[model samples]
Target: MTPTLNGPPAPPADTRCDRIDRLRAALNRALRGKPGVVEYVLAGLLARGHLLLEDLPGLGKTTLAKAVAAAVGGTFARVQCTPDLLPGDITGFSVFNQKTREFEFQPGPVFAEVLLADEVNRTTPRTQSALLEAMAERQATVDNVRHPLAPTFFVIATQNPVEHHGTYPLPEAQLDRFALKLSVGYPDRADELDLLAGAIGDVSDARAGAPVLAPGDLADLQGRVARVAVQPNVRAYLVDLGRATRAHAGVTLGLSPRGLLIWQRVAQAWAFLKGRPFVTPDDVQEVARPVLGVRLGLAPDAARFVLDQILAGVPVPV
Candidate 1:
């Protein structure tokens, strides 16, 4: 059974002053044995940006989103992206009333605290725009009506890279909006063995992933994340790192200013998760792949090359 969040059984092991550890426990419990994945996901959330997970089918992408949503204690919604989907299908339209002479705003699936957009690329570009708007701005403007989103609105959108028959590659602008993109690759031999042997009952339900922390807790966490210090040299190093992606001859597009901002936030979040108040070269090195790798790659090995170039040329910003 899921533990109730309304009242505490006792004082926390440590989060009375800081809640990152508590939040991590909640995610790790649901994501069991994938703490790195948990860190990457939380980094995006800490940065207050969206995430994209591209991998083969059945890597538990939906479950990951749901689990993370539960850990943060937010309302989660999943949208199965299909070819026939419409804008109204996602951002809900206002239908005119002849008698009343006014239209009412009908919210679609985008108004939740967390949204899992499954098979995101399967839908046409038009349909994808609805999500892109929410992912980028944290609000959806339909018929010139702007609807504010939840303070903790987060999107975990995924696509199957192996299958391209009906898929649409997310455009560069759209890809730029995601703070980070990751792959939930096939689980290691151990996790897979546990996965195969584990019963369905082992999976935690939405309510099971219930809020261990409240919205204010998240606000406090992000505030603490922002304060997780990055040294001047490290800031220079991060800039040089992102600049290198754009300057790479093979890269058609470079990481944007927005990407630079989000990645800096990501680096700080990463450091904070490790229980460090100050960021180090290791923090930058540890997160470069997940935060900037996929978003700035050229070809199959493009992203890896970008990281290599930065590491070799930048000398860790110290």
Candidate 2:
């Protein structure tokens, strides 16, 4: 059962909000002119979920991922996935030490607190599957030995939407692992001008400032998010929406039970971000699109239409 706010008290609201605001500022600095995208990204992180960024190259996806790592002051690792990439290359492998005459384990990028898998679909399915275990259970097993990853391990994977040749599409099972799929579109004219001006000033060469969050701060905030209450009626509203997805003719596969759970958690995080102690039906609707987009295997336009139908059909609880 999920915990309630009436249980143990969390950190003071003012303090948590200040830290979250600083984190938001840091992300805005990294990916200029996309506050909406940053909002969803922050919600996903607070929900302790992974992110899947699907867009064309050169859209600041890498910059956003790096900024997230820096904001939390965590170890960051990037994997440039390719067709020839091996599973062992990502999850590490056991090596025999000639001098010690014993096998030694070498950790891979998965061991980092934040991992960016660039061009994830470019890698073969075999190599992609290497991340499944690590993502789902926060552990990597090689040679029948299990290695635990960081407690706050987070992955921000990217894929090119327009490029399909020589790319392996992520199967539904793999897609279900992501909490939200986002696109960082082009910035506004003014923001782009600012970006150009900053570039001329060599802003890209500037190092990240002090982390917005200290060690263990993220996990503590996540715990607080989990305690954000979801009223019984709001939960019923979530269930109605999930069932609506299943019955929709446009949807081949609907939201799963795991997806429903994730939706609730994300709604809770959204409410917490809004400075609310409990969830409401509005919070559920606010996050429906991104949560369902990654799970439903439909074209973008059709997916939006189906989602619209589902949300419109469901009755919001008072």
Candidate 3:
């Protein structure tokens, strides 16, 4: 359950959305020319789901993650995952304390409000599995004891798609945990030139002047996202779409029941971002690609085509 904020009550719903819009603008500034990427990332964040960024190197993946952490005014940590990294390193381990005459639990980077797992696929499977519980349960079990993570423990993991030389591909179960996976493709010529200018100059902090929403307030916004109504007809449309994926010839494995819930949450967030109180079919279609494409097993190009077919085949409920 999402913990309630103890301070003054959260601002009204409109105020909260306004605050979110400010953060979105800041992210757009930080990641120039990728408004769609920024929107998807924001949706994942509001849905309280972990994100997987699969893109080439130096595409501002880390920069986007940092900008999010900064905009939210949350603590951020980046783990440069490697083959030798141990589960203990990500989740931390108990150390013998001579003064206390007992083992003392030392927390790891996973305790932060926002964690960036860079080149996550490069790490061993064992180390990769360390995040499963944390991502799913918002808590980590170490030394056979349960340790609760922060209420807003969001993860932004990045992996390189161009390289397969030394990487452990994430299993389906692990991939399912990510709410959405996206690529920050090369910018357009105009955006590229503007980026070059920013490169030569001292780029200002993206969130420096922006109004920073308190952590608790952001949590309240997420709660509001959860409450975003999904009309019955739209809900049925989601189920039909899921069934279509299962029947697709190219798909060896289809989205699971859990995937449907994640899809709804993401759609709800999208609707909320669009200033809507209820989810619409358009919202679902807008988010279908990133939400479903990540979980499909087809080739990257094929996945896009299949998604388009799935959407086109499904009757849009009025």
Candidate 4:
């Protein structure tokens, strides 16, 4: 049996769908010609999971992250990660107050509702680990004291794929925390033309429009997403895919228990976005690539081939 969510009942399904449509439009405007990418981003958001965008520079990765922060309507904070950045810089540190003569905890970017860690791979491993606890628990501990972050805390991190000399690749543990890893490729010619046409306008107007969902509205939608029903056969199919990943000779590391759970939740969010209350085999297959890509620890090309093989081996529930 599915556990009942604790939040207030969600708005009517039609109302929720309309709100999602508005949010989608806001994101689409922010990143033109990538509606498919935007859809997965929404699924990750509604799944209450973080996002990792790995792509070449100047491909609208940062732009998309900023748009998400703006559309979500929260205290947005950005960190341009570097090698010298310390863990405390991202998670916060303690300072002795001159007046009060007591140590005061200074909250860092992790406290924000929307955090964008640009070029995350540019940071050292120690600094990269700072986000581990925060992303997993939605809380930060400083001076052994835990500070609760906003219920809607969301992270959108970007990293360059071509640069390797000065960058530290994200460990499997860190990659596993993200719901999906996406690449925002170059825009099509028509979209590029449209982009150039819009570029002539005032750049300041490019930001996302008014907040689509009010504060707490996103959390409600996420709660509703968690309650989307999953049948026994679909659950079994998910397990089968996971096992196949483990058995695949090409894959060095397979999906962990946590990854499997995240896959189910993301599929549930996908179903909710499609205006359905129950998860289907199609929904599971649709989100398979992104959900599995981040944790598979293989190059994009090799991973694609291996993923295809694994999917082919697993029988889809009827």
What lDDT score belongs to each candidate, Candidate 1 first? 0.76, 0.89, 0.87, 0.89
lDDT of 2 by residue, 183-210 (tens): 9998899998988887875745543456
Provide the lDDT at 220 for model 2. Answer: 87
Ten-residue region with minimum lDDT total, candidate 1: 1-10
* Global lDDT of model 1: 0.76
Clashing pairs in 1: 73-211
Q: State the lDDT at 106 in candidate 3.
A: 94
Q: Name the lDDT value of residue 83 in candidate 4.
A: 94
Predicted structure 3: lDDT: 0.87
lDDT (0-100) at residue 140 of candidate 4?
Answer: 93
Model 1, runs deviating above 4 Å: 1-18, 96-101, 200-208
Total clashing residue pairs per candidate?
Answer: 1, 0, 0, 0
Q: Candidate 3 regions off by >4 Å?
A: 1-16, 201-211
Sorted on TM-score, best first, the list reads: 2, 4, 3, 1
**Predicted structure 4, TM vs. truth:** 0.94
Put down candidate 3 lDDT per residue, 205-317, tens digits, no spaces. Answer: 44233436875877988988887778788999999999999999989998788999999999989988887667889999999888987788677799999999999999999
Shift of residue 192 alpha carbon in model 3, Å: 2.6
